[model samples]
Target: MLKHGLDPADRRRPDRLSDRELADRHQAMQGFLTVAGPQLDQLYNLVGLSGCNVLLTDAHGIVLDQRVSDGDAQQFRDWGLWQGADWSEAAQGTNGIGTCLAEGRALTIHRDEHFHTRNTAMSCMDAPIWGPDGRLLAALDVSSARADQTERYNRLISAQVASTARAIEAVFFRSSFPGARIVVASDDPSEQAMLLAVDRDDLAIGATRAARRALGLEREGAIRPRPAADLLGRQDDLHGFDRGERAAVIRALARAEGNVSQAARALGIGRATLYRRMARLGIGDEPARLSHD
Candidate 1:
């Protein structure tokens, strides 16, 4: 705080963005906000009745949206926890929102853990949210100034805050690749939301941060396109079956005279499943015309 020239005893509120600047920032994050808005509301619904307020902030710690009860709005506003408030570590010292963004992690700052004396009455639990491209995107925070709030209760809220952040990241990732198929890269609950986006040709198009880390992709940038089967290390029968499955599919298609539905019936598989198998085996729509009937 000393290096930042902040006095721990200072009672002045943190600086805020002007209406014009705030509007511009909001516009910049409009897409993410649109996707994450429902998750934010769900989080608020979970904790709002407990005398807590839920806030979502951009990577710079400027509050983008907040949910607070009508009765406690003035108290939270007076404490500089409203929209447009600047809570970057340089501005607010070691508070939850600022510190979570600074450290890129989930944590709790309870009561006097606040750097500013006036903010000591509030307790905050926060988690850092990652964008679809694996960069720092935003922070999700739950805060309370209730006199009866306990550290134990804050810990519980902290867990929910972290979970909600991951949910937002998952929703944003899926929305980012509207045409791609999302595959769960990991079944571990700890790796919940570890997902990969694969195109129609089974080429990996994108990955969530956890998926990127799990699959050895670059940690902080766009992932290069690669074969999803290669990344997943699955035994795709295209080459692995040594032409057996491919030959069988070819024979079936030839027998059906290029009608995919008829071929699927001969192969005893669903038409969509046959199409997927054909795609996996590099089969084209123009099947061999072995027979007119």
Candidate 2:
């Protein structure tokens, strides 16, 4: 359960925060306030004109920064929206930030969908930000008037919030874990494998467990960080070598049931590479057995 307060509808209002609670939170957030600059601007621009109230919050749900169009900003602030406000369920009731943290999932809450009394007039979408180590770092939210929102709009807003959160996470990962090799994979499984910083010796790292499995690593323990050479098989045929570019290609082929062209596109590789790899790996031109059926 989330430690923050419950949704407004779930229970009666608790007494306001004690002085100590306020002081502790303020002290805990000094570092974040200092470093938040261009990223905030970027987020503002990303969602500024979308008729939504965008908010950045700490892991614990304290509102760190907010960006709404000039027209909406004043209204939102007048409604008690501002820095230092806590939107966690404990503070503002069952809303995007609190529920996302509680469930650890991207969420969409339309007006009246929120579990808190004060939030009934707003629709919100939120995504939880995760650090490279998979820690919950923060939550990004886009809230707006419920009258004009739809499921599709909610999805688009949530996607934007997720993207922004990921960008921030990437920056955070690069700065805090300078020596750690970082690999950013698309949430989409079919895209060609994009590998970053593969040459850094100290940052040597391998794909995630899922990526290793996709690459057909026989043993679980064999998936540790190693030279890129160790992972790629022979490079005799250009086509074959190209298909072997990344594990994502192999996974796409399997998922597509051996549809070469489809797999190639999903892996973000040329069709020729798929064919070449098929030949090199001894995979037949004809679809695999399952596809044949």
Candidate 3:
């Protein structure tokens, strides 16, 4: 704050967004709220059973939504965990929401880890929520009053919050492309894995940040990242569709039961386009056989 001309000693006086600013933030995050609201409510109910309150904040760290067990609601509010409060690192110093936004990942800020002295009475765990296009939309946090049990609870809640964040990403991805094929690329069906949206042109249209990282989809530009592909050998198409496109085609076909029309529809491409891509990629007469081979 020294650089910003604000005093760190003035931490007691909280800052908040104005009505116009709040409204703009709300409008900016409307779509994310629509998908996250109901699911977060369910999560709050479950997590609240453990005496923790749940909060959702925008990318800017303004608490957009909060849910707490009635008995603990006042306690949480007293700690400044209510909606519309600006908890960005600039405003509140180090905190779960603020720190997570700064770090861009899952985190748990225990007592004394908080920069402001007043907020040291609580422990917080948070994870970033990403949008369909792989941008950060918000963060989900769980906070509990600090006590002897804090260390144990922080570890448990951190993992749960991170899992919930991934579920939120799944919702955003599926809602963004209702017609595209949703493929779980990981071999383990029960584990949280990379979910890919295969587009009509036999290419990947969307992938969660986790999937992108797992597949090594390096950032090509700010607006969009590149596709993930298994490294192919000599059979790989050079001038036409590459390994990435081939993998997407195989996965889509496998899920669609080898029906060219169904696979084409799932990829959001026409039957002719699917055939053309397959032909150009040097796929032989038995394209369905390619998936098994």
**Candidate 2 lDDT by residue in tens digits, 1-293:** 24553445544432334567756765775554444446667767866776778777777776766777878877677555556666676566667887888787788877877766666777778887654344566778878874767788778778777766655655554554456555544446432222222433422353433334444543333234554544544344334345445344555767887777778777777888767766666665653342421
By lDDT rank, best first, the candidates go 1, 3, 2
lDDT of 2 at 289: 40
The per-candidate count of clashes, in order, stands at 0, 7, 2
RMSD of 2: 12.4
- Clashing residue pairs in candidate 1 are none
Candidate 3 regions exceeding 4 Å error are 1-13, 190-193, 218-293
Candidate with more favorable, higher TM-score: 1 or 3: 1
lDDT value for candidate 2?
Answer: 0.61
Candidate 1's C-alpha runs over 4 A off are 236-293
Best by TM-score: 1
Full candidate order by TM-score, most accurate first: 1, 3, 2
Lowest lDDT block of 10, candidate 3: 225-234
Whole-model lDDT values for every prediction = 0.88, 0.61, 0.76
